[model samples]
Target: MANGVERELVLLFSEEELREMSGVKRGGEYIEVTCGCTSHRYGDAVGRLRVFINGELEITCECTPGCDEDTMTPAAFEKHSGRETARKWKNNVWVIVNGEKVPLSKTVLLKYYNQASKNGNGSHRSNNGRVCHRDEFVRCNKCNKERRFRLRTKEECRIHHDALAVANWKCADMPFDK
Candidate 1:
């Protein structure tokens, strides 16, 4: 009964017929059907069909003739449309996640790229003296090795060395101080 919604005149199918056709059991506790048309003003017409089940608002599928089956729950739909999540970066870029600029692996970056692209901004590095460029790897201040710096001060670094020397530091626990 909402605006833009129309009641269809299609014949109702029996529970057995619906089950056989779509493998979904009908004759549940609740069922409601609603339809509406989207005014695009350009391109093809878009229609919506909603089905409620068990007294709960359920499936809402969009129909445009050539469109694919893009049916989902409200939570999933919002996440896919980049409306309820943060942007994700891709390709081992330096990104600030939870206030730390860390090198994200390629796998992590790909998962959030599309969402980030829609949010009007790309991945950003934190301002805690961490490198921001994707190609620039972090180098240790003492050894110049391509290792992730843990933001330790000179005093902390010295303490780490002393602890290791006392234990005859094993390679398994090289730089991390206890």
Candidate 2:
């Protein structure tokens, strides 16, 4: 089973701020691109980002209406790092969420998503390659505070349910999921 990871993208401007700066009127609705390819909308809490994870510099138009013409042009955002293997356009950017800046890099993202195991803990991830979200209770070793969250169970197989297995839980940030 593959473990899941979460990576964040930090934007320079908030989605709302970007809408204002880009001359997009807000009506709590999706805005149509100049070419009318497709309408774009941001969620109430989170905004989506279209980013390239490969080294290729392929740019496409978000314009709907079936226009084949490319819309946005790629600009040199940063220099290539020594560890980065991308030969062309730097596919790295930042996103802002809740007034916090999060760096989005292809290399960094790839490093995170490519791993099948946790950095230290081997059992925190579910068989579905995601952080366990099943309800569980665990006492922290440091603060000794019992934190309950939704994570997966050890005997979670394809068959019967185990109501008695409720107490079998993982720790909160323990060296291992004991």
Candidate 3:
């Protein structure tokens, strides 16, 4: 009877279960486990099979059984998830930052807007009242120094433009050049 009970227990866990049990569990609040070709489990699951950290589900799996457990806070989950899947384009546009897709928030859009407004009209217009034909001739509005302001359309000196824009927007008014 004892021998039969042991044999039954061995048969209960299928081959797949045996493989999963053998695989490594990389422990972390947010861990990514890959079972290589030997295992056919890869899919994100939240709760239950997935474990959480700080009161929120942080560890997402690409495995089949789905995730179980809750351990991270909502804030931590968002932060971790965002970083895991951030992708960038050749054009320097971050298609995804962290796991969240780009353009989902105002961060990228605001960056684009500020880049477009960098040179102000002054740099575009030459002394003759003609638009500067050379990209390098445009003077940064903030620094009053000439640079290849091709990347940004605003008049800010490359170093100060982003900071100025952020300050201006935060204050609900254009920042005074100090």
State each model's CA lDDT, in order.
Answer: 0.33, 0.31, 0.32
Q: Give the lowest summed-lDDT range of ten residues in model 3.
A: 31-40
lDDT (10s digit) by residue, model 2, range 70-136: 4342222222112132223233333343344433442232232323332235345656756553354
Against the true structure, candidate 3 reaches a TM-score of: 0.15
lDDT of 2: 0.31
Indicate which candidate wins on lDDT.
Answer: 1
Q: In model 3, what is the error at residue 137, expressed in angstroms?
A: 22
Candidate 1 residue-wise lDDT, 1-178, digit = tens: 3221222211233343223221132223322232222222322222222233212223344444565646654333323333323233122122233334333332122222232333233333455834343222233444545543332455644545454354333333445547
Residue 121 miss distance in model 3 (angstroms) = 3.3
Which has the greatest TM-score? 2
Stronger candidate by TM-score (2 vs 3): 2
True-vs-predicted CA distance for residue 123, candidate 3, Å: 3.0
Once superposed on the true structure, which residue ranges of model 1 sit more than 4 Å away at CA? 1-29, 40-54, 60-62, 73-178
RMSD to the true structure for each prediction, in A, is: 19.5, 15.6, 20.8
Expressed as tens digits, the lDDT of each residue in 1-178 for candidate 3 is: 6565445434433334334322223233321222111111322222212222222223232324443424442233333233333232112121233343232122221221232243465455545765553333334455555433342434545534554444323322333547
Structural RMSD, model 1: 19.5
Ranking by lDDT: 1, 3, 2
Collision count of model 1: 1
